[model samples]
Target: MSVISDVSIPPARTAAVSRRFYITAWRWHFYAGLYVAPFMLMLAVTGLIMLWTATISGRDGEKIYSVAPQASLAPVSAQAEAAFGEVAGQIVQYIAPRTAEQASLFRVNQGDASYMVAVDPYTAKALGHWDRRNGLYDLADSIHGTLLIGDVGDRLIEIAAGFGIVLVITGLYLWWPRDNSGFSSVLVPQLSAKGRQLWKSLHLSIGFYVSLILVVFLLSGLTWAGVWGEKFTQAWSTFPAEKWDNVPLSDLTHASLNYNGVKEVPWALEQTQMPASGSQAGISGTPEGQPVTLDAIITLARALGFDQRFQLGFPASETGVWSISRDTMSNDSANPLHDRIVHIDQYTGRILADVGFADYGLAGKAMAAGIAFHEGDMGLWNLVLVTAFCLAIIFLSVSGFVMWFKRRPRGATRLVAPTVSEPGPLWKTGAIVMLGVSLLFPLSGAVLVAVLLLDLLVIRHIAPLKKTLS
Candidate 1:
């Protein structure tokens, strides 16, 4: 497993083309790896931490709310009353208890501060309170998603993810078994090999196995990214506005309800208009004479088969609706096919809309399943698989850095990056790929162009890079 060696090319006319593409692949693989390695390492480490914490303490502060099961539990309103008393504020949302031994959660807003108030369902006593999203897992998640710096972090991560995809493509090409190399070299690390061979063997074998799964993980994770996911894909894949049956829509969308970077609603409904409460046309929701209180909404939610764990969001404004929903992102449901959100008019207490897995567009539906798989929320099996993949990513990141360190031109302090051996038709094809990546991920594409321009404008004229691409 030597670098820049394609002894696999036999007596064939396209050997030149094949050889040129191989070097092209190697060059870009090297380039993408340099930029993507650190980001990938951070993603894997934080992802594993989040997973471990989720497994041990629970994703939604369940440890703070764990309670002893009782013969009879308190009413939902009593729990809300207790939570309000503890927080001394309005209960903006409620997450129902998943099981008998778990207490319910209420999001209370007291002035400018918000808190997650945990109440024991059996006795309707305030169990505890924590500032919303102030836990260790939440901090790790914030970094994992946006690096805790908002939209700029989001764009940086999106570009990293895009380059991550490029890494997979080019690495696979570089790892494609040459005629001289056996499948053993691709599948297994050779222990008998020493020094650079050992590192090369490990890096190649691990990169080959992890590349496919890594791409799936990256694409699924990118759905939450601001640029590629939201600006482009989500806009086209969202729930159809026409499905609302001419109901007067509110000025705000479901995205308005997602606070503190938490997705309280489904991905498909994020941009779709929230139905206004003033609309009179809707299916039966709350009882006709029942005053629409938090208790009434909870009662309606339970009756509508929203028992166990589900988020019930209070109306945000006069025209807003009481929202009840379960989605994988919220860690409420394991199965995306079972994901759904229902809106009830605040004034009329009628069902304004109910969007489920079936309502999602094709891409939306793919994202639904992909998101569940991405977060390892589907089940224990998925959790194990995602954890294993995270570990593999960490290994790849380390092995890649080791290989680069060992293989860099000896005695050279500056970069000695590999380049294609000769200028040929492959450059034209690569231009097409760069075009595709730029279009698919506009932000990352801009980065690719900038790097290319840097090479043309600066690197070539500089003292270091004129050594000619091998």
Candidate 2:
């Protein structure tokens, strides 16, 4: 038959098939909704709040430099002395200058600008703000991340992510076409101006297109759930680290030492060693004459092909350390835009650790790329795509519910229970086989087994309550 002629389904057969599909979809949808709807709603609301984040927060300030100045990447002890004077007593701490700097910046909290200064190591000139801005992005981040509810909010989101996976799986099963003829009906919407055509098209069409992305969104979200999920990813990704396997207790007591113009002092970083897990390593502070420059550092990092946006944290004190972390555009995780860390010594202006993209193992890179993709930072185009998908998900979920509620029958199915009858013993045997296969995903499998046991042993056998409930 021609593709167009294939559309001609008998009315009785079509209605019968539609009835079966609706019953199956409705049954699972009802159960899944009972289990997951609240969590899904929580995600939807949080997502919407995050969409407007760039407007609410303030930007953290950065150091501003002039072309006429050329300074050394030196330590900041001398600059601290000149800036604070002798009475400034006990260099307490220094702020790392936000520069490709060799200078250790310091803050005396002497007056109005208690917020640290990014001082020049050679000239002692004060630089700009060191903290990030608080803008709409921060507000959206907080809403998406913690709902302003702290730990409780995080836990709720984690649970929601877990529930989301189940919803997707059950939704697929419920949506699957039963026969070859049912394929078009399940996959596409009818164009004939019949009941709820556009609504049906919107729901089914969107869900079909976004199935893969939705799955990634749900799975990536689970990475934040807890230690269990963390370990699961670590294992799946095969992340390796042997250096932290052994630690000498004696190494903990001794503090590293540093020097002021006329005196020596103790510092924490000097005594500590980074674990061998491919962590970025760098010494703390710039040398007395060789100050690090922020612009220089950015150029260096870019040379390493980390042309993505980065945030530089200046050393807070003469004893403070400089740090740089690559920043991604958003929450998508599949893009490898931000998998880098850098540390530089503030005292001598030496590269402590510059972990490049190539330095990470296979799994680490995959994890990084996944994170980038999830954040919608793969590129500008993906950002638009993900935003569109998010809107589609929200719309589909609402429409699907509306369709179900509108067509639901008024009476209980109790009268048909006896006539419906149980599946044959062979069916039970097949269920056991299926349960065996499901056990690979331990958590989901255990839940399924428990559910099956409860249904068979309790729901089916408990006659009095079964009659009333059914």
Query: lDDT of all the models against the reference?
Result: 0.83, 0.48
Worst lDDT window (10 residues) for model 1? 461-470
State in Å the error of residue 417, model 2: 13
Q: Write the per-residue lDDT of candidate 1 for residues 305-386, one digit (tens) a residue.
A: 8868999888878887889998887888899988888999988788989888998988888888887887788889999998
Report how far residue 53 has shifted in candidate 1, in Å: 1.9
- Residue-wise C-alpha lDDT for candidate 2, range 378-459, written one tens digit per residue: 6577667767877777776677667655454567544222122322223343344345435433444555567678888898
Instruction: For model 1, state the Cα shift of residue 231 in Å.
Output: 1.3
- Per lDDT, the best of the predicted structures is 1
- Per-model clash counts, in order, read 0, 84
- Mark the regions of model 2 whose C-alpha exceeds 4 Å error after superposition: 1-26, 55-156, 173-186, 193-201, 235-308, 315-320, 329-338, 410-470
TM-score of 2: 0.60
In candidate 2, residue 72 scores what lDDT? 51
Q: Which ranges of candidate 1 are over 4 A from the true structure? A: 1-17, 421-431, 464-470
